[model samples]
Target chain A: MSALLAIEGLRAGYGETEVLRGLDLVVNAGEIVTVLGSNGVGKSTLNRTLSGVLRARAGAIRFDGAPIERESCAAIVACGLIHVPEGRRVFPNLSVRENLDLGSYARGKPRRAQNRERVFSIFPRLRERASQYAGTLSGGEQQMLAIGRGLMAEPKLLILDEPSLGLSPLLVEELFGLIKRIHADGVSVLLVEQNVVQSLEVADRAYILAEGQFAMSGPAGQIAADPELKRTYLGL
Target chain B: MLSPVILIPVLLNGLMTGAVYALIALGLTLIYGVLHIINFAHGAMLTAAMFACYFAFKTLGIDPYLSLFVLAPVFFALGYVLQRFVIGPASHGEDRNMLLVTLGLAVVIENALLVNFRGDTRTIDVPYAFATINLGFTFLAVPRLVGFVAVFVVAIALWLIMSLTDTGRAIRAVAKEKLGAQLQGIDVPHIYAVTFGLGTACVAIAACLLMPSYYVNPGAGNAFVLVAFTIVVLGGMGSVPGALIGGLTIGVVESLCSLFLGDSLGQVGIFLIFIAVLLVRPQGLFGAKA
Candidate 1:
């Protein structure tokens, strides 16, 4: 199987300080690949660079066999590369239904109604509170709404950034289950997460990022079983 | 002592003045809502539109109302270019810089008009300038009535566009959350340009409507700008309906104060109400608390 997204020598950062340096990664079709890293390990930066929110300082990023290194964020989204950003940046003023409708502003506009129905089916709680303002939702519900909004775009590759950050343990398990279900629907997911064991359980392959580069990479089960990795990063 | 019969004409005149004020405030509020910038150049843009209509009347003998077709597109294009070239880059910078840039733009445009039109007051002498509509109880100036009706039509059109169209949804999305809009593949810079264009178009329409009754000068917008600001603040910074209500309220207040307190102190009453609104409900009558 060929890769859906390929990045090589990716370098990105804020002004005068580099976060990601010479990072190389690949996400293949029909797989869940988690980039596990602690806070400030450039995981968010990676997602930002890939989504074209931040300009890649120096790198080549190819999505779906085309170089998108110079593409605008909107253009990248038009190609079905959707990013559910960190901190659930849902439009607080807009209703749940309006937020989901806006998700199809670019790629899924033609099928907005159909995609909205699909998202509503997937997240029935969102459907129940469709008219409620997004800001009024609980943290877990907000996360679900964010993901559901991303799904409204009909993304080929969905990049989730710290989706389980503020959710409770029970909600985290449900979110992981939802991620697994999403994968089953044939969407490629790049799960940038800190939830080690849970992410390992769901991801087909895992890469541990440290100091702006991959420290260890292998099958999920292998990484989870490694005594050194469990002791050092996972804290198991 | 003012008689109760005089109150009727004062109220009718207030409504007419309020309609024009609503048009100006709507443009200011819409631009502020979407762009997150208090556009100081809005008044200058209105002045530019007035001048454009004036020139069209002088050269082509086009009636002020008919000149809307020509002026709206021109001002819209000017606004688009202004946003794209001047405001877009500065938008991402400091709020202070955006404020200063718009202020500077206002100065430049005002002075340009002063140089071109030589600060002389100009008014289009339409045949119905002094015509009055008799409603048995009150008399309505023909131009003012037209402007009053036009304000409702424009307001309804804007509300419909915002609620019904895809482009309007995208604009609202951007105003609410810009990053989310971009993630949805919205060209945010393009949206900004279009929104600025729409705001300018509103001013163009206002200028055309006011041509018959109001004089056009380089500084004509200065007085209206102060009132527009008051209306937008009173209506809420970004609320369309709020602007209309605020405008009407100010108009009535101005008329009543001028009647009872004398013309010299009319604005004093407006300033007091403005201060009271700020002290009591800083969000304005219709504004959502931020």
Candidate 2:
């Protein structure tokens, strides 16, 4: 399979301090790639830079064989790289349905109604609470809504930033199951997470990020099996 | 006397005036809803709209009612450009920066008006200026009656725009979550400009409605601005319906207070109610979420 999203020599950071230094990664089409990192390792900064919200200090980002390093957030989304940001940033005042509908505001315009139904089927709780404001939902329900909203965009490559955040262990299991089902639909998944064990179970490959670069990279099962790798790097 | 015959006219007068006040506050509230900033330029913008209305009538013989059609769009475009190119870029979506930017804009617009107009109070001589609706108890000016009716129409129109249109949907989404809105590919700057334009258009409509009954000068809008700010706060910052009800309540209170305590001191009734509401329910008449 060809690379759906490819990054080489990626570097980005806030002013005067670099966080992501010469990082290289690839997510081939129809694959689940997990980027596991500890806090302050710049997982969010990497996501932000890839999504074009943060300007990449220096990088070449190829998405579907075209350079998108200079594209705007809107342009990146239009090209079908949907980023479900951390913290489940659903519109609080807007109803669940409105939140889902807004997902296709830029790209999947023609298939908006169709995609919304598809999203609802994936997250039945969202359908039940369709009329309720997003902020009023339970934490798990809000995360479901956030993912459902992202699905409504018809993303070819879905970058989920810490999807299991603040979710109970039971809910995390369900969220991972949902992620697998989403990936089964031919959408490449880039799962960025601090929940390393749960993420590796779902991801086909895993990349451990440490101090702004990948410390170890390989198949998820292989990475999880290596005792020295786990002992020195993962602390597991 | 507290008799129905005497008090009813005063209440009616207050309601009609309150309708116009509601429209003015609606403009301010719309801006606050989307931008999360109390626009310091709102009064100056109103003064500017009043001058435009006056010029449309005096120089071109366009009736104030008819000029609403012309002036609203013009001001809409002006507001769109102001927010899009000026406020949006300068403020970078920060609330404090927006406050400063709008405040600076207000100073510039007011001083520009003062320099150009020379502090002269202007009024229009519309043929309908003296026309009145003869209620059994009192005569209400026809223009004020028209304003009372038109404010509802405008409110309904604004409501429809906010709830129904795609642009409105984008606007609401941005107001709630700018980052999420951007991720959805909604052009945030465009929505901010559209919202500001819609708010300014409301001011234009208010200017047209007021021109028939009110006098205008460089500082004319300053009188409305303070009361509008109070209504925005009392109504809850972004609630359109809240502003409407709050304005009417304040208007009636002001009217009844004046009947007992003369005119100048009577205006304090609005502030008194404002303080009471803030003290009792800090969220104002409506719950605070925009």
- lDDT by residue for model 2 over A120-226, one digit each (tens)? 88888888999999999998998899888888889999999999989999999999999999999888999999997889899899999988999889999998887
Model 2 CA lDDT for position B33: 85
Q: Write the per-residue lDDT of candidate 1 for residues B159-203, one digit (tens) a residue.
A: 888867767877888888888788778888898888888888888
Candidate 2: residue B15 Cα off by (Å): 1.2
Q: Please provide, for model 2 over B1-290, each residue's C-alpha lDDT reduced to its tens digit, 9 standing for 90 to 100.
A: 58988799889878888888899999999888888888898899999999999998999989999999999999999999999999888997576798899999999999999999989988998888989877777888899899999999999988888777668888888887999888888888888899999889988999999999899999999888899888888999988898898778777888888888888777899999888878888788885743
DockQ of each: 0.74, 0.76
C-alpha lDDT score of every prediction, in listed order: 0.89, 0.89
DockQ-derived CAPRI band for the predicted complex in model 2 = medium
Model 2, chain B only, scores a TM-score of 0.97
> Model 1 segments beyond 4 Å from truth?
A234-236, B1-3, B90-92
